[model samples]
Target: MPSEGRTFIEEARRSQIIECAVDVLATEGYARASMARIAQRAGISTGVISYHFGGKQQLLEAVVSEVAKTATDLMMPRILAQTTATGMLRAYFESNLDFMRLHRKPLLALVEVVTYNRGEDDRAPGPYAEQHETSINDVIKLLDRGKSTGEFRDFDSRSMAIAIRGAVDAVPARLLHDPALDLDALAGEFVTLFTLATRRQP
Candidate 1:
């Protein structure tokens, strides 16, 4: 049981360090969030970070994965709760905005990391990196389903899906500039806009 307890403790410390990293990155931006800052936030020595993650790059990847997992876990159930394709698509926007509203800090940090943080080669986060498109793909699936069911018109589901994801993603920067930005109103607008764009006219 000693080994099991040690493993559990290590996992706990990793989680703590990742959470602190998210907070630091979110509040201070990528350039300012160093290993020492994250360690200080977690109340651990810098060596603990090295022992657990080896360096900042690994920790940044962990932070990205954690936030992506969070968005999936939070939004998937809501998206699936609706039966109709339009309803599913609407749920995607609403649930995503709700998540952004609730988990602004970690998500903002996530955006900064993917957009600004570069590997040793200095490349932007690769296609294999950053926020996965599972959620957006799910929206595309809903559009395809609606089209199959004669509920939506044919007009490039893939393009529309990308547009929809882009719309909500632009919110974080807006919120940064104006913390009081009405995300709910914007979500509602997107829901209505996309619904009309995808739906067949009666």
Candidate 2:
């Protein structure tokens, strides 16, 4: 019982520290955000963060995981609610972009972490690369479903998927540069363009 209590408290503390790390990363920039700063923000000792996460890289990974989970949570319900493939595609991108708008700070922090956090080998964000592949595969699945239903024209689904993902992925930088960027307008525009491009001939 005592061990269970300790485990629960440890999890709670780890959650708090990760939350504070996201806040610090967004506000301070990735290069400037240190574990000590995150600890200060969380009102905990730096040793506690180190004990749980080991280092900055691990903490950044945790932040990325949290942000991705949040995005999936926002996107999956909307995607599942749609019966049509076109509807699912729109739901996937629009809801995802909407999630970005709603959770700008955390998403931006994720961008910073992915763009700036380098490993010893100086590779690109390992998690972003993996997640991008997963996203593209999901888009391909939607395209294939639409094709199977005779709703979409027979085109290269992988190309389309990559294009759509590229457009959506570019939004974070745009929003950062122009805070007043209209994401819904962008979302509607992209969905309409793709729908027209992919729809079967009358």
Candidate 3:
């Protein structure tokens, strides 16, 4: 029943609400990011948020999907363009750290979402599961490419992928817990460790 302009405005408003929710979730964890708080932060009515996203769970899902998509879009091209496995792996770590630094709020929210449901059934058909699987698959693909080029050692790419993922996942917690931690230095160390782990030995 709305006009085109009105629909576009509504969509924009919804996007704003989702972003605000992400900020709240990142700063105040998911449990504290209530509908009222998010609406207040977005400068929108709670009813509007409810109308658009149904409830907090749906809004959280939307936020997760948006953040994950943004990260994948930003990193995938850099990863694909690398000419060597080492170069690709370096690109992956650097791009990931840069994304985390630039998009701290949403990235923190993503970490919270991940940690909050760590032991849950990650294989379930949902946005969280899909995002997790996509991340693992991307890393696996990179490892496979590396192995194909003889740049990486002959090992289970899947297990190596999980280890790489674990390192990336651990960074956010370290940063949050110790603001003085040198992330750049840590990233270099991580890249070195990853290279050592996958390097083809003589």
Q: Per-prediction RMSD in angstroms?
A: 2.9, 2.8, 3.6
Report the C-alpha lDDT of model 2 over 81-153, residue by residue, as the tens digit: 9999989988987998899889998988988877776654575455566677888998999999999999999
Candidate 3 colliding pairs? none
Q: Looking at model 1, how many pairs of residues clash? A: 0
lDDT of 1 by residue, 13-132 (tens): 888999999899898988889999989999989999999888888888888888888888998898888888888888888888888889999878877886786665676553225445
Between prediction 1 and prediction 2, the one with superior lDDT is 2
Q: How far is candidate 3 from the true structure (C-alpha RMSD, Å)?
A: 3.6
| Residue 65, model 3, lDDT | 86
List the global CA lDDT of all models: 0.83, 0.86, 0.84
Instruction: For model 2, state the Cα shift of residue 112 in Å.
Output: 0.5
Which window of ten consecutive residues has the lowest lDDT sum in model 1? 123-132
Candidate 3 ranges with C-alpha deviation above 4 Å: 1-7, 117-127
Cα lDDT, model 3, residue 118: 35
Output the TM-score of candidate 1.
Answer: 0.89
157 Cα displacement, candidate 1 (Å)? 1.9
